[model samples]
Target: MVMTNFLQKRKSVRDFKNKEIARDSIEAIKNYIEEIEKETETVSFKFYENGSIIYNGLKGKAGYSGVMIEAPSYIALMKKDEEKESCLNTGYYLEKLNTQIVNLDLDSCWITLDNVDDETKKNLFGAEGTKVDYVVAFGYGVGKKLFTPETTSGRYTMDQIVFKDEIGNEISADELETTGLLDIFASVRFAPSHKNSQPWRFVMEDHNVVLYMEKSDEDSRSLVDMGVVMFYFEEMAKTIGRYGKWSVILEDQDKYLKVAKFSM
Candidate 1:
């Protein structure tokens, strides 16, 4: 529930103050990146100290449509290769790093470089820039705007996502609460995904939770979304004294694709 509350309050800041992060804070972020990178070698993070170059080059080029979130600094995620596992790991660790960014009293938003080409990426970010799929824009917010109504996305409930033993069977709310997993599910549902698609499901069988990703014909980054949810689920589970390492099982089925399993 505590984790859920933290997630519920977590929002992407599209409007940031036109200010650079402090020198100490920048060093702290670089140090955090080093600390975060060691845990997952498949995904590499690069810090853009002067975001002007990145923001200038990527402006009107990448991001959700053509608008890029202008921030004082940026962080790019590069996968080792074009592997599904690498995509998942990229999502997982990106969220992990974002958590730290939030903890430091900063704001961040995930930006996809889908529309950008490899040649442009290399020119903008150096040779390894070609491998970058996602970059995060993080900085201090311009503060809440007055006379401006904020827009937020909606999340699905357990009955819509959690299934009983398999993909199609329905899992009741009573079963989830009795199993002491009600809070875990409630919290993890808030995990951020691409366009807030939240294309993930759970098949709980024999007290173990099996993760599945609903194939989206429109989004190619669903595997990355899978990894993002896995991080939050494990995090919320630990607060309730549940612990398990995810064993990735990316096998596709007729209805849903099996992503991973947690035997807790």
Candidate 2:
């Protein structure tokens, strides 16, 4: 499958077969990781089996069942370097690579603050000055459809998640289609947030999509979330054959409010 096709087909998978991923598949993952690592200097990855020490930390931890229990293979996404928005960049670029993994017919789930074997992760990656923001569990799921939580878990619609100019001024789904903005925003709506907080808002003007942080906090971690959403927008745009460029526009001394516009 093509990368964009993979992005469209990919969803979080928690149920998996007990069998290990194929050696060729593992090699494929490693090669892809190497290529991405070269482009994005901050990120690296390590793979492990389900029973290995890497996956043992959360064995007895509460609320770790569901998809996490059955991930026969694990990919530990690691990043190094500080200063600037490093963790956010880690999530952004690593997820782009994960999208490619979907094209390979594998399953993945992003682990943020839950079901993580911290010590084992650190040992495997060997912590530097950097922090392990999160990990993604990957493998071949058991059945065709693994029942994504989006159905029962609930998700925000385009109107609720995105705005045209202000928080109260919602961009209706119908209006979005008329404006041809739905394709990009659709992907942003599906991008994962911290515990599904979805603390992002969009201001669509002309062809530019300006990202603004709306939550109570704009700390380092939030920048990581920003990076995640940025990746989603770029990938979604490319998937739909609308290519755009992104850059961080420093607006204030605080460095919280960011502007990432799209240009034809």
Candidate 3:
């Protein structure tokens, strides 16, 4: 599928078929990981061929309420540092790699491992250069690939999540329409976030767009959340005529984080 269509229709599969991803598919994934690693400095991907080891080790100790999503394979993001940039790139490139998995006729779900301590993560995945902050379990879903995965997820309207010049300054739909960005923003509301919190907000200027995320708890997944939405926005923008990459703008605004800026 094309990028825009894939972003709009992406679904998380929690229940996967009892089958390991084929070896050829795993090789394709490794190539994708190597490609992604070169695009950024902070993060790399580790594919665990045997998902049982990770699932068994992380069960009752990871994910929401310590409930792990079982699958036939798992991929972890390894970043060199625990800084904001590392977390952001982790979410960005991980989601980018996720699209490749979907294109290969597979489904995946993001698994948060923050509740799992460092020692356990090291012991389970090994103590190499891998710092596994998050894992994505992936395989064929239980049914047909073409069917839409049933979803209960909802999204904010553009006005609810976007602003004209600054936070609390609402940007009207008609304004976005005039700027040729209404449909793009609407489609990106489908981007996933932790517990579906969304957490992403935008402030638009004449020549630039600024992204912000709610200040989540310290060591929380919200920065990663910012990175996920950032990819969506840039990809969606490309569908139109706007083309630019996000430049980090790490700052504080009492309750929200100033994440990045993109020139239009």
Supply the TM-score for candidate 3. Answer: 0.89
lDDT of each: 0.83, 0.63, 0.82
TM-score of each: 0.91, 0.77, 0.89
**Per-residue alpha-carbon lDDT of candidate 1 for residues 1-264, written as tens digits (9 for 90 to 100):** 366666767677777888889888888889988988878889889899888889999988976558877899999998898788998898889998898888788888888888898888999878888899889998998766311224444778777888888877998889889888887787677777777788999989897899999887843488889988898888888887888889999898876788899987
By TM-score, the better pick of 1 and 2 is 1
For model 2, the superposed segments whose C-alpha errors exceed 4 Å read 1-10, 49-51, 61-70, 81-84, 113-121, 127-130, 143-154, 165-175, 217-219, 250-256
- Candidate 3: C-alpha lDDT: 0.82
Against the true structure, candidate 2 has what lDDT? 0.63
Question: Looking at candidate 3, what is the lDDT of residue 226?
Answer: 79
Query: Could you tell me how far off, in angstroms, the CA of residue 115 lies in candidate 3 after the best superposition?
Result: 2.4
Candidate order, lDDT descending? 1, 3, 2
Which candidate model has the greater TM-score, 2 or 3? Answer: 3
**RMSD vs true structure, all candidates:** 2.6, 4.0, 2.7
For lDDT, candidate 2 versus 3, the one ahead is: 3
User: What is the alpha-carbon RMSD of candidate 3 to the true structure?
Assistant: 2.7
